[model samples]
Target: MTPYLNLVGRDGIVVLIGAIDMVPRFHSGNLLMRRRSLSASMIGGIVETQELLDFCAHHGILPECELIAMADINEGFGRMERNDAKYRFVIDMATLERK
Candidate 1:
């Protein structure tokens, strides 16, 4: 989380989603100097999650993503680092059975 502080642009916000057990430690200067903010949100309960999933399914809504084989995970990381991959990467676990 500390590493992410330096990554955001000035006046940027880092929103943490879901549970984080580890106590985060970072310098106040990191936020003060850049006008950054650290915020969090709960994803919601299982029932609410299920309802959202059902709504999307009913509406035929889909997320934009790229499906990659497990073997190409390193390449996927590289793409992400280079900002080449524009969408989320979903690993096709079936590829693991190939070799």
Candidate 2:
């Protein structure tokens, strides 16, 4: 986040999203001197979420994720342990049907 602050222009804001538990530490002077700000936002409720989904669909925006079969969860864990998994692992529930 410290390095990211440098990338934003003056008065630009950095918005942190999702469930981040740890408090971020950075030099406050970077924000103060540049009139920049940091903010956190929730995804919002069902209706707003649907609107966001619609906007993303209209813009052809998509998330990057790796679909893994339920049977291969152990391998997935191994990949995580070895830091080999580059994308978020989304368990494909339909994969369980074969078993």
Candidate 3:
């Protein structure tokens, strides 16, 4: 979140986030001033979609991500705020069970 300040401060960069629950603060004026939008989107169950996962497997496509335990969600959110996390957040229950 802090990293976004530089881009949104005066660079007119759109801040696209899926969630803001972990972000501590924000300046709406700064976003509006640059004709930029802080957009939040709901990517409904894309990871759970079997078709998509199969497509990825078929094409050998996978995101560069780190898998963390569900217990580490708080830490995950912290990393997210710092932009340290790449793509993956929490590990699914099925994946956890296998381990």
Residues forming the 10-long window of minimal summed lDDT in candidate 1: 90-99
lDDT of 3 at 12: 46
- Rank order (by TM-score, best first): 1, 2, 3
Residues 4-96, candidate 3: write the lDDT tens digits. Answer: 755543444554456556645777766666666555555447566777789899999988777777677788899877867766575655545
TM-score of 3: 0.39
Runs in model 2 lying further than 4 Å from the true structure: 1-39, 97-99
- Ranked by TM-score, the better of candidates 1 and 3 is 1
lDDT of each: 0.89, 0.89, 0.65
Candidate 1 accuracy as lDDT = 0.89
Q: Score every model by TM-score.
A: 0.66, 0.56, 0.39
RMSD of each: 3.8, 8.0, 8.4
Lowest-sum lDDT 10-residue window in model 3: 8-17
Tens digits of lDDT, candidate 2, 6-78 = 8776787999887798758999999999999999886698999999999999999999989999999999999
